[model samples]
Target: MPSQGKLYVVGIGPGCEEMLTLRARKVLESSDYVIGHRTYLNFVRHLVRGSIVESGMGREVERVKMAVELASGGHVVSLVSGGDPSVYGLASLVAELVYRNGLELDYEIVPGISALNSASPLFGSAISGDHAVISLSDLLTPWQVIERRLRKALEGDFVIAIYNPSSRRRAGNLRRAMEIVIEYRGDCFVGVAKNVCREGEQVLVMRASEVAESGVVDMHTLLIIPSTESIVDGNWIITPRGYSRKYELEVE
Candidate 1:
């Protein structure tokens, strides 16, 4: 058996190649093996060399095992995930696998832009205050847990960013979420960003009441719900009173 090597879990940002950070690009070019879902693999095809493993949907565990196995055989492996590695990405699973298997290997997580950050600028300052990120897919988690979190977000008056809001089989969750939020915040700000950082990106900024009627959002879309204090500012929507000014003072 070959000596084990290091594993680098890299985030490729959203879907745009240009959005890829310099370190992520470097790791991809230098790694001996690359592993990721088909779409994510396609996104970084140009940057990768050596052997590449393309895992399709519903095969995440298998993909992680493959990457670990390759790395255990002395191959420098780079595992790619979309958005931030820590946010609904494969980093946690990979770490769990390594611990369970009792494999001694070095690994690092490279951060990248999450959908929330990518979509935030579209809606004027929706996340200027405190907020939460929730994934509505309910694959690993139960729907009840998701609902509870949604309720907390509403009651706390926190801006919320929802990922995997709707899919073909789970199409009505977003509407349900809006219904719950409306009960707490009668009329709030809502923004939808579709295919962010991709070629056909579109941003829609509207009232939360209008989101259900807009019929323009999808699974690829990210929903940003602004706090009560958020407001629209021309084409650039943002949350005011950022911490930058709080820390930086003007010199006389």
Candidate 2:
């Protein structure tokens, strides 16, 4: 009997080949089977040689089950995800399936840059200060839970990075989010980055009020709501804590 192969949930990192970590590349290169959404697979198609298993959008449960089955049946499998696999990716789902199905297989999660990380640099590190990251998609999670987290983050005055802010079928979540944020911090700074680290990227720096007024964000856009201390310097928006002393003159 042939030895069963292990599984790896790999993060490809924000739709860019350069952003893919060395370890993720190695795992994909060694795998005999690769599974992921078509778009994610396209991002790393040149880096690996394997039988591809493409998952349709919103079919995460099926994808996880298939990847585990392949790995348990003696095929080294690589489950690819955009950005960090553990962050809004297949890591948790795969682990859950393993636990429920009693599949004994070795697996590891390979981390990669998330869209939030990629967007931060473009906006002058808007997330440097305390912040909260949340996903606005309510497919798997209830709206009440999402709203509760948003309210808590607002009360804490933490900068916020929100993912899946809107979609064609769910166009009003971003506007609602802005309304909630405004109730706590009126006219707060807000930055939106679409397709970060990829071609055709768009970045918008504006106020939370403006975001609600404009109504232009979508699921691809990553929204950053700055705290009270954030400031704009020309094209860059940053949150500085008056730490100039770290770079100022020394006492002579």
Candidate 3:
């Protein structure tokens, strides 16, 4: 029996080549096959020296199965994902498939800069403290569950980072999210980071009440809804991580 080749689950980051990790780049360049969603594949097409297998958004299972088949045949494979693979990416799916099938596959997961990592800097310490990352897309998960999570996170005063907030078909989701946020926090600051590190990048800090009317959010947008303790200082939204209450510091 031929030895099974290694499968590398590589995170390509937010479409910024410089933000791509060295390990991820090396995996893409050295692998005999590179497989991923078409959008993510375009992000690192320049680095892939191997045969490319690109599929559409809803074809994740197909992509992973193809990658696994190639790797099982002694071909090194790199499965690319946007943002950190473990965070709402393909790493979990691949692991599930391998475990459920009882396949002994040699695999590794490479982390990369996620949207929150790339977008938070634009908000200037908006999520410096304890936070909750939630996805608004109800494709796989029910909306009621997502709403309950949002309410609980808000009630606990946790800063929240919302991903996949809205899209063409799910336009009302973000608006409803903003409503829930406003109910708990009473019109708090909501940071909208659109197309982070990509073309037409935009960062805006607006009130949660206004988010419903602003019409700025989309699928590419990541929201940073600060805790009640957070304050808007000049051009930045700063979340107080209890540093001042714990220690006395002289300000110049």
User: By TM-score, how accurate is candidate 3?
Assistant: 0.95
My TM-score estimates for the predictions, one after another, are 0.89, 0.93, 0.95
Compared with the true structure, what per-residue lDDT tens digits does model 1 show for residues 90-140? 889988987887878788888888898777865645576578999988888
Q: List the candidate 3 regions with Cα displacement exceeding 4 Å.
A: 248-252
Give the top-scoring candidate (TM-score).
3
Superior candidate under TM-score, 2 versus 3: 3
Could you give me the TM-score of model 1 versus the true structure?
Answer: 0.89
User: How displaced is residue 2 in candidate 2, in Å?
Assistant: 3.8
Model 2 lDDT, residue 27, Cα: 95
Per residue, candidate 3 scores C-alpha lDDT tens digits across 16-101 of 89999889988999999999888788888988888998888888888899989899889999999899998899999999999999
Model 2 per-residue lDDT tens digits across residues 1-252: 779689999999999888989999999999999999998999998888878888899888888888888888888999998899877888889888888878778888899999888998898878886789999898888988999999999888787899988887776777788889988888766888988877779888877878756656877789988877777665577877667647764578
Best by lDDT, which number? 3
Global Cα lDDT for candidate 2: 0.85
Best-to-worst ranking by TM-score: 3, 2, 1
